[model samples]
Target: MQKIPYTTINGGSVPMMILSVFSMITFTSVYGFDSVWTEWWWTYDGFSGPAWWGTKWPICTMGRYQSPIDILPDKLLFDPNLTGVVFSSEKKINGNLTNTGNDITLFVDDVIVPLINATSGPLQYVYHLHHIKLHFGHDEASGSEHTVNGQAFPAEIQLYMFNADLYANYTQAMSSPNGLVAVSIFLEVGKIGNEAYTMISNALTHIPTKGQQHRVHGLPLSVLLPQTKEYITYEGSLTQPQCQETVTWVIFNKPIYITEQQLTQLRNVNKEGGSHLLIFGNIRPSQPMYNRLVRTNINFRPKTKVCSMVKEVFYEVNTVQTRSGR
Candidate 1:
């Protein structure tokens, strides 16, 4: 059953997060990829989908550490060592967006003014953002791979990053220990949209089919992130094939917002040569946590009474500023 929206964890069986519901237009067809560059041509389903991925790469099925684990806020350990991660980059970044057949990724390797790097949280070495991957489902209830208390978000934004401090490139870092970080942000639909998300949403009109490319200039990477800084961290692997167990995952507690119309734009992208949408449900299913240590910096204390008292003293208007981080 779907839970109440905006439910926070104080204690007990209540969910950590449940996004506000809205009606979403449906796309029933499944598309293919034209620019899929993988040697094996692995997909999410059918002939050679996720089920067959382990046959080609043993680590996928054998590895103890895998990514996109469901996060339980109540069970998350409060680690004092976990702190706010700082993101540094040029005022704006330039990149070409591609429908990789897998997901829509923003490749910013070439046009970086200086560099886009994240440091000082769960990361021991600096990691560089190589690309941005967007994952979504056919509808609003189930897109994000990582779930909060078993509830999914509409979509997810992943910073496919590599440890630049220890490795030269993502290819080299993919297999090495402590080589990559999965910086994930949850995406939900709201009334007013985020400017950066709106820009990308509008640009989607140019690339409706697979293997299509569009250039996006002056993208502020910082604007895509949440300012709250509180997050959950764990050691895990890549979500796809050859699932290397060399990743440090930092999932923020706060979610970013995009307009319902903007999300529909993302839902409209196709894979390769079909009327169906590649983005209809491109997200990987959440893997088991096993005995993994899930840590967070967020204070899980009850806030119902505090919010009640504060609401009387200060009545703030419903504006974008209320959600400053997103």
Candidate 2:
């Protein structure tokens, strides 16, 4: 990590470590500017895998509020106060999609791009879209970071937004309280391909290796999201380094669709130094619940599948409402 030199009263230079609030890292798969073009510091396996994250960033092991939790339908509390998240998307947004070595990340040009933000439903302050990270596994059965009753999706799109009302920039917001809102949308393989995702897939050829970037222009941000806004909300930490517990996670209840061909393209993207080894399995394992509260607006009584595995979790659900309120 390169430290910028700070000039003191005596004109002497002092090394200062970059202290980004959220990991000072918006994410693993990320959200802030501090680590836009940094080299691969940590990994998904081997010596620097998730298991060893705490050795360098202690919060990964010590923190009570970790992320990527397996959401059991039976272990969810239905919050009447919870409505859909209020999203404001730019009609057309411009950004650069970069292969950040470990994950593919998209960062918007805040200057040229009109403000794309979201508020309400578990959010207290207005959050500005900072970055987007794509996480996947080597195969279909093990890609998504967050699982449902131990069932993982093909991929996960993590849209990291920082509180614009509370902080000046993504870097500053990442370190503050009520700092970030990570909107997670799962991707399922389907016959039809989402146009927004198609645009991304087409652009993948331009950035076939690490540290490469492709300019994406005139993209409809709303097209990237599913029609439904219903989601499960929780208070958790970033899935990356520093693992700050300042994030509010909004995981969409409904999944967006993508094509199998697109999935293959992502799996084909080469890792650092343009090695033949494709970039795959960049997801983090699910963390402990730690007695944290998980809230949702979706009523699942009629749709609930009996999962005896989740018998010990604590939650509140309206039996009468689900039975009568259709």
Candidate 3:
């Protein structure tokens, strides 16, 4: 049976005490969110026909603002009104790292620990931290969900939040139009590794099989984000099934670095039930922009000053060489 929240007035069951302790100490699947595993294009079942999804899950084919769209640098509009996003979480938040069938998720225990809160970007309401998930591939070439100028990064990370002002729970928020916010950061392979991600990557060896969860403590949410706050904002749906169009996407312009060893650790997680099938490469193909305006917080000038100056010097030298030849 699903565990219920504890109350001080009614008490005394052994199971209740255990449940309360576990809930306060860790984050379990409170929402019970599920995605279709068999219907994906990359899966062994391999039934990727959009027609089938239209029949089974209409939202997959019908959503107007679908996620994982390529962000064309030339196409983005500069929104002077867009403000910088504010993100604050506890310095030492404890969590349980779970190898969910689809991806690896770090579930924060917010009841005992302070939950992360974000506000004031392109958002009208305050958003409370929900969870974080990782998406990666076999190599450093192509793993990210959203691409910039059709270029894919090695991996990507998504930090999710639910609108606290509008809804009391996650299910209700998923049903609303503006109920979720996702902060996406791209990951690149580098010489040095990220210490924040080491907490999760180190635990992947223990939870190789699906449905396996391990406890992790004192994880700082601040270290997981990119150093820069500059980002591109757009309206998009969840990349997974049920394809809810409730997310306001804030994809960071800057990417964080992870080492080759760290990437290998992420690629080692297996499919559920001891199948031993590594859950590597879970990026959904980019969706069409379809007349939607991708907005950025800052204005982008097309050319660099240094490049323009170099071009002028090169032109002058070329003319001199040509005149001498004549």
Candidate 4:
């Protein structure tokens, strides 16, 4: 039998040094180099294999009792007490368009909604509108929400609001449903085009791909709201990741329209530093029915009071202390 010679380095075994170096390289490749760990390992199920983890943790498993759900008009019941009053200060705002290859940014304003009111129940919660974001796609049919007749709209705008008192940080609110409310608006391609697009588009030249800071003046949210005020309401969650089921969705029946050229400019926006910001479709797919009810509301008229018959589920998470002691 032949014997292999042992090597030493700095009063230690050389083999151990080689092994340590190999371990470090493996660790760096798996974690330090990229975000693969966050995408796979840090999820609900620990990383094992594609099949094992995928089965254990499907898409909706991470959701709480409530989540972001799509509401169909026919299924909703009208309610006068649960009405939401729409108000805007007519203040112009601006932000940088950080188009980082995937999502495009437009009018990321610092909005503050000091007040919100809801009906009494588990869903009775007040929140604030923190900021608003706009996303446009290549074609009119590539929006987030599709019509019941299976027709896609032109663009989608997400008004991201949060419980200003509950979670001081946006990231915390995103991970859990209790602190966020996203009002989504679908835009259609019309012959007249949308006037709201003009307010942001005329300033597009000032905002470059890498993110040029642009200002908007007198761009009130009322311009984007549906005139009819007839909306489909449901108890859902945020559409983004860590999909918490804590949002009260109010989807308007009518849609706003924008021209093809305005849509092109919005799609061309890039994130800061010349990143390849590809503003593809940013809307999440419609979620399950989940034994939830959809409600609707019309103008205030002399009619009998009708209550929403939606099924409600109790979430046992400890309530956080708020300034209002809610």
- Give lDDT tens digits, candidate 2, residues 1-326: 96576544467654444333334454643543434422456888888788988886788888878988988665677787887898888556679999877889889898732278899888988998888889999898889999887888889989999998878888898778999999998888889988888888888898888889999987777998878756888898889777888899998877778999999998899886647867789988999887677778776555664322223333345333232110
Worst 10 residues of 3 by lDDT: 317-326
Best by lDDT: 2
How do the predictions measure up, each by TM-score? 0.79, 0.81, 0.77, 0.62
Clashes of 2: 5
What is the model-wide C-alpha lDDT for candidate 3?
0.71
- Write one digit per residue (lDDT tens) for candidate 3, span 135-212: 887777678888766677888989878898889866688769799998998887779877787787888877888788
Q: Report the error of model 3 at residue 47, Å.
A: 1.2
Worst 10 residues of 1 by lDDT: 20-29
Candidate 4 wrong stretches, greater than 4 Å: 1-70, 106-126, 175-177, 203-218, 267-277, 298-326
Each model's lDDT comes to 0.73, 0.79, 0.71, 0.52
The lDDT, on a scale of 0 to 1, for candidate 1 is 0.73
Candidate 4 per-residue lDDT, tens place, 133-213, comes to 565556766665423323456676666666555776566766665666666677766676667656766776676554345
Residue runs of model 2 more than 4 Å from their true location after superposition: 1-39, 112-114, 301-326
Candidates in order: C-alpha RMSD to true structure: 16.4, 9.5, 13.1, 11.0
Cα TM-score of candidate 2: 0.81
